[model samples]
Target: MTDRVLSGCRIIIVEDDYYQAHDCKQMLQQAGAKVVAVTAIVPDLPDLLAEGRIDAALIDINLGHSHTFDFARELQARSIPFAFLTGYDAGMLPDDLATNVCISKPADLHRVVSVIAGLASRGG
Candidate 1:
């Protein structure tokens, strides 16, 4: 039962955990999104973004030694919509970033797909 909720959307996943990244990529693909890239390294994002159009991004807060706050700001500067898909609570993020959509880990695929669809549709 593919919902196709994210049909035609191009997305990137940035998560440090291999299994988590894989699961998210698979789920997004199943939901009719193009999983442009699944990367654990934050520094690889610029190269990946340059490769093609990305409708939205699912970023993890803590990528082991680094964080995605800077990248998130970059995305904002680009006017690209993105959401944090992290295990950490939304309240923990800096005040400016806390307002962005944040989905908890072990999330329901349906909810993930729904939120992504909304974000992508919002000029992403």
Candidate 2:
């Protein structure tokens, strides 16, 4: 286990997998982050964003039958740092998202914490 490196960071999880989301929430909380919301649908994100105070986001590339590319763009526009938590490789992503941070599924929780902590610190 890692230290409470994400202390005071507020985050959102955009993943459809119930077990993955639950595990991630627990891990993030243990690392000292406040998980503001967890949603499987992109359309629901606006309301979550409207509530404000999100430091970063951990988003899955594929959600049910759809993908989160456009949602990722919106997050970029809002200047909220985010990382893709996907089973796909970076080369599989679109050109625009290829440069963004990406963490594969079955990820190392400690490493995920470190990445989120860094993103939160950057604040965009």
Candidate 3:
């Protein structure tokens, strides 16, 4: 294990799967991110964003029965930097979101740390 690089940054996780969410949280926390909240859907997302503390987000491409593209749209509108963390392959992502940073599930913790480091460095 390495020292946490994202020591003070706030992260929000949007994953519907309980085990996946737990894994993500553990990884981020290990990397020193302050995980403000984790949610399974977009309906409560706006409220969470309104709290004005999230530095970035790691979002699952699908949230149970719902796709997270709409949530991604909202994040874009707010100018929040986010990355897709999905079990699905990159080819499964929508055409419009193809350019966003994405990490395959069973993600490499170092890569995830680097991604968050870049986001934080960019003032996300």
Taken over the whole model, the C-alpha lDDT of each candidate is 0.85, 0.88, 0.82
lDDT of 3 by residue, 1-124 (tens): 4687889989898888788778778888988999988888765666885776678888999877989998888777777788998888888877877878999887786787789778766764
In lDDT terms, how accurate is model 2? 0.88
Give all TM-scores, in the order shown. 0.92, 0.93, 0.87
How far off is residue 56 in model 1, in Å?
Answer: 0.3
Candidate 3 residue pairs that clash = none
Q: Residue by residue across 24-115, what tens digits does model 2's lDDT show?
A: 89999999999998888875667876787789999999997899999999888889899999898888888977888999998777778888
TM-score: model 1 vs. ground truth: 0.92
**Candidate 2: regions farther than 4 A off:** none
Which ranges in model 1 have alpha carbons more than 4 Å from their true place? none
* Candidate 3: C-alpha lDDT: 0.82
Report the candidate with higher TM-score, 2 versus 3.
2
Q: Provide the clash count, candidate 2.
A: 0
Number of backbone-clashing residue pairs for each candidate, in the order shown: 0, 0, 0
Rank by TM-score, descending?
2, 1, 3
